[model samples]
Target chain A: MKILVCIKQVPDMESRFKANSQGVWFEETDLAFRMNEYDEYAVEQAVQLKEQLGDAPEVTVLSIGPDRVVEAIKKALAMGCDRGVHVQDPAAATRDPWQIASIIASHAGDKGYDLILTGMQSQDRGSAQVGVTVAEELGYACATTLVGFAFSDGTVTAKRELEGGIKGVVRLRTPALVTCQLGLNVPRYPTLPNIMKAKKKEIQTIAVAELLKEEPLATTVSFHPPARKGGGIVLEGDVGVLVDQLLGILKDKTAVLR
Target chain B: MKALLIGEYRQGKLLDSTFELFGFAAQLGGETAFLLVGDETRLPACDGPLYLAEAAECGEYNPDLHKQLILQAVARENPDFIVFVHSSYGWDLAPRVAARLKAAQVSEVIGLTDGGFEVGCCNAKMRRTVKPSTARAVLTIQAGAFPARQPNGTPRIQRLAATGNGGLEFVGYEPAEAKDVDLTRAEVIVSAGRGVGKKENVPVIAALARALGGELGASRPVVDAGWIEHSHQVGTTGQTVSPRLYVACGISGAIQHLAGMKKSDFIVAINKDKDAPIGEIADVLVVADVMQFVPALTARLQR
Candidate 1:
């Protein structure tokens, strides 16, 4: 079985993000980057699926971004993916979901992969729309935020996350897409052997111009940074003193005792 | 201008985020119509005209079929704006709808501005105000960002053609076998994050919850670590809660965690780092070690 796992390198979530001095977008330069947390689950799931399948399940990890974003594709390679595809697009940083998915679908749709996997949402955009769009663009069935899935014959049984902790199971035929959520599987750290091998794996680079249509479907009108919350009163003191103050306030003004 | 709000339902009941779309339509300030594409069933109440489409496979969410049903509805209605909740369902369907319509989308929107809306970006470390370029645009509004517009009275409903089921099939949900505590109804939530340090330390936090006479809640990391039950997870992808008081212990308040509990009436965040984002909404920020503070607070409350 062949699988395609989509990964993205996003600015470190722990870093202090600052808006671009002139625009609404974040200052991308000088920020640390990592593979999206959710996609880590996707990569891990792909690896596990390969292990379960017994054969060297030809797993290819794909990413779209500037040249720097190839690091994420390599990270997936280090995690045991067979190869990598970097759809080089510098503008991917600000491109809308439709555009990005369209570019990916063009390549992935014709590739005849048995399955396509991606993170439910990106840590940066957090749109959770790209995988679904890519599925639609590819004329394939798709599921989102799936926590549990199993492959059998030509169909897959999947468990989905709904609001309020409800889990639902669904069946979809092969050539399907799934956007993975957290808790699906613990992503493994790349071992020394795998990390060395990752440096040797071939990453095929494709230009965005060859895949994108003449005009993007969507365009951003303008961007401005959102207002920060006026952090409320911050109490200062020792841990015990702070607890005393919090308890007094909770007891008097809130429902701590109630 | 006419704005169409697509409603998503599971097991014959509309999701809570469905109503929140009404708030988006209201904010758009125009003829707001609620659209539901599924089996031939009655739709949830709407303040504006409700458009219903009965489809063969509309029982559950089939991204392929649902997008087609929405496209038909959009073509018939020619709405200026098509709105959806930024829930999993919306995230699954909206972009395809936008792609088919050849329209633009502004997703994960948190606030409405004069010309457009604001979306959280960079892990909610910052927000970006965006205006769509398309005359007819699509949107996925963030959950809990906008209040649901209460249904005024009997909504004027209209039915559309039945769209057939697509390549996908609907399989019923397997509710987590665990008898999970629903946090939505909790009066007070004493929530813990990874800062509690270890699995053995969870009970101290639980003791604080018990002392407060409240339910125990946990962030995604703690629950994923098996430090707490998955049912106790309170975050964007978990159970959303709006308790009267939310005591956050050691949680740095990631956007996902905030998405679940920010609606609480009063927030008390106890984190070792004072610079955590939870302090923004926190009624009182107690900067201290959670391991030390939770026990002290529990003792004080019990005393």
Candidate 2:
């Protein structure tokens, strides 16, 4: 089985985000980029699945971004993927889900991989729609929020998380798509030797135009920061008095009889 | 324009988030129609018409079957927008339906507007360039993000007969249960993260929760460490919560963790690091040792 794991580079979650003067987007100069936190889980899942398959399965890491995204490709390589394919696009930072999904679907179609793994949503875009959109485009069976998986004899069984403490396990045939949820597995930290080995791993760069026949469907209008939260009112008094004050405030704000 | 509210009904009743979607649809300005796919049962006191597609063989959620039913319903009604709750089932069904209908989908939406809906991006802090496309949109509202209102008086309920090519069949079903506590609806939550040291110290936070009549929660690390169940995890990867009060003990408030519970009514963070993101958002930021502070706070609460 050939498995393609799609990864993305995202701004570090800890960094402070600031939009540019034109309000188009965040300034990327100072932001440190890394493999998306959720994608790490997806990559880990792919690596584990390959290990379970006992040397028969070939795992490939595929990413689409600017040249800087090679760092993320290297990270995936250190995680034990057999090869890396980077689709270089300068405008990747501005591409929306439809465009990104189109690029991925086209690449996956040509690669003819049996299974494609993606994070349920990218940490940066968080659209959570790419896997499904790519599935729709390629006409493949897709599953999301998958916490557990098992594969045997060209069949994949996945346990997906549902709302309200419910879970559903479904079985799918080969040539399917699955999005990895966090807590699926702990991603391994690359050892110094592995990092050194990853530096020499072959990374093949392809152009987005060569990957996809379609143009991007969407464009950004503008970006703005979310509204600032109002200053909180601190109630000063004893616990009982504070509880009363809090209840009164809640009643006033929500107008609930309780 | 009329809008269709696609609801996932289990055991003959609509989910709470479905009602919240109805509340949202009413705000979107239209005669809201609800489509329920399940066993043959009429929904009582709905705001608008309820179309019942009963397929006993459609046991578990089959995306193909749902897409066909939803498209047929859409063709019949031709509503401008289709709304669903951003639940697992909705995640499975919405995109397929949207693709079949060629409508734009906006997932994880927190609010709506006159011109378009305000979608919640997963990496809201990062990729600031990509904006939601505003065509006829398929939207899934985040659970608990929108307030549900019970409009006065019973709504008109019109039931439609089940009609479609039902080609999907369920072989069997097995449900997986997580031992973790579900913290999404907890009224009060006390969570600990990696900073809490060993698994032995987790009970300290639990004691604090007990004293305050609240439930114990954890970050992904504590849960992954096997100290607590995945259900008690209050982070993006775990459960999204909006409790009355959330007390974070020893958590640094990673954005992934904050995305799950940042909307709580009152946040109290107790961390050794004064500059932790949790401290920035807390109503009361206590820069004390969690090992020292948790037990002391629990004792005071018990008194």
Candidate 3:
């Protein structure tokens, strides 16, 4: 079976993000970059599925971004993906979900892959819409937040996480979309040998304009930072004094009926 | 312009967020319509035109079936805006409906204005830009992002007939049991995080909660560690709470975690590290060991 996995590069979650003077987003220059936390799980799941097939399944890592994104693709290759497709478009960074999904769909549309995998959502956007939208664009059955999966006889049965501990298990045919959740599997780090081999793997770059002929559907208005919080007062002294102070604060805020 | 508000009801009563959405819709000034899909006995009362999609096995949420039902409603009502709460069901189902209708979606919105809306989005990345906007917008209102409002008296309720396309089938459903204490409505909440050390120390926080007659909550880390259920989690990835008094213990307050409980009336954070982000927002910051403070505070409260 052939598998295609989608990956993205995002600002490290630990970075203290700030807007530049132009009122545009720019991570602190001192910050670091890494593969999105969730996409690692997607790549791990893809590699495991290949192992289950009893042979080296042709795993392709597909990423859409600027030149910097090839680093993320190479990381996936080091994790044992067969090859990489890096769609290089300088303007791709500003593309909305529709445009990004369209580009990915265009590549995977004719690839004749049996299964397509993606992280439930990118760490940066957290929109959680790309995988499902791509599935719709490709007319494939799709499931998100999938925590469990079992494959047999050209059919895939997967368990999805729902609200309040509720789980939904569905069966779908081959050529379906599955977004990997956190607990799906522990992703393997790149070994030195694999890392060296990945450098030799071919990376095919596709331009965004070449891939997407239609104009994007949406435009961002502005980004606003969340309001800053006030400083806190440290309460000292014995437990009785603390309780009295705490209760005093609460009583002023809420009307205690009793 | 009119807007359609979709709500989910269990066992006949409207979910709490439904009332909040209705209040929000009233401010936007539109011909608001409410759509409820469930068993006949479980239909909720609505203030606007109510479209009832009844099925024998509709007690559980089936997205495929819901897509068909919502598509029919969109075609019939053709509202300018489609809104749903950012609940688990809404998050799961709204995108599919939006995709089917080819509508632009904006999830996790905090407020609505006449011109557009102010949303709390992770993708906005703490900066504003006009290149990423879209029309036919579908937005999911974040819990606790807006203040809840009382229902308007005498909302007109019009009953519509049930319709089905029969393309999707309901296999089965397992209802999630309701919790005894609804943290979202609790005025005082005592929350624990990974810093509390082990699952065995949870009772210490519970003891403190008992003293203050408050609910017990958890951050996503503790919830994911299996120390507490996901329902008890407070964060962007978990449930959002807006209590009058929120006590966060040992939580460093990641942006995702802060997004959930930042609306609390008074936040008190107790962590060893003084620089924990929770300390910045907390009204009271206790720089000490949670293990040492929790039990002492519990003792004082019991007195």
Name the candidate that leads on DockQ.
1
TM-score, chain B, each candidate: 0.82, 0.69, 0.66
Clashes in model 2: which pairs? Answer: A126-B122, B180-B231, B181-B231
Residue B152 of model 1 has an lDDT of 71
Report the number of clashing residue pairs per model: 2, 3, 13
Q: In angstroms, give how far residue A69 of model 2 lies from its true place.
A: 0.9
Instruction: Find the candidate with the highest TM-score and give its number.
Output: 1
- The TM-scores of chain A alone, one per candidate, are 0.90, 0.87, 0.86
Native contacts present in each candidate (fraction): 0.68, 0.29, 0.41
**DockQ of the candidate models in sequence:** 0.57, 0.31, 0.35
For candidate 3, the docking band is: acceptable
Global lDDT of each candidate: 0.81, 0.73, 0.72
Candidate 3: misplaced stretches above 4 Å? A229-258, B9-14, B40-48, B57-59, B113-115, B122-135, B147-218, B222-266, B270-281, B285-303
Ranking by lDDT: 1, 2, 3
For model 1, how does the per-residue alpha-carbon lDDT over A14-112 read when each residue is reduced to its tens digit?
576666766646788789989999999999999999998895679999999899988888889999999999999987867877778888888886789
Cα RMSD, model 3 = 5.7
lDDT of 3 by residue, B107-127 (tens): 666665443566544333342
Clashing pairs in 1: A168-B173, A168-B174
Q: Stretches of candidate 2 above 4 Å error?
A: A215-219, A233-258, B11-13, B40-44, B47-49, B122-135, B150-189, B194-215, B225-227, B234-245, B250-266, B271-282, B285-303
Task: Report the candidate with higher lDDT, 1 versus 3.
Answer: 1
Ten contiguous residues minimizing lDDT sum, candidate 2 chain B = B163-172
Report residue B18 deviation for candidate 3 (angstroms).
2.8
- After TM-score superposition, the amount by which residue B208's alpha carbon in candidate 1 deviates from its true location, in angstroms, is 4.1
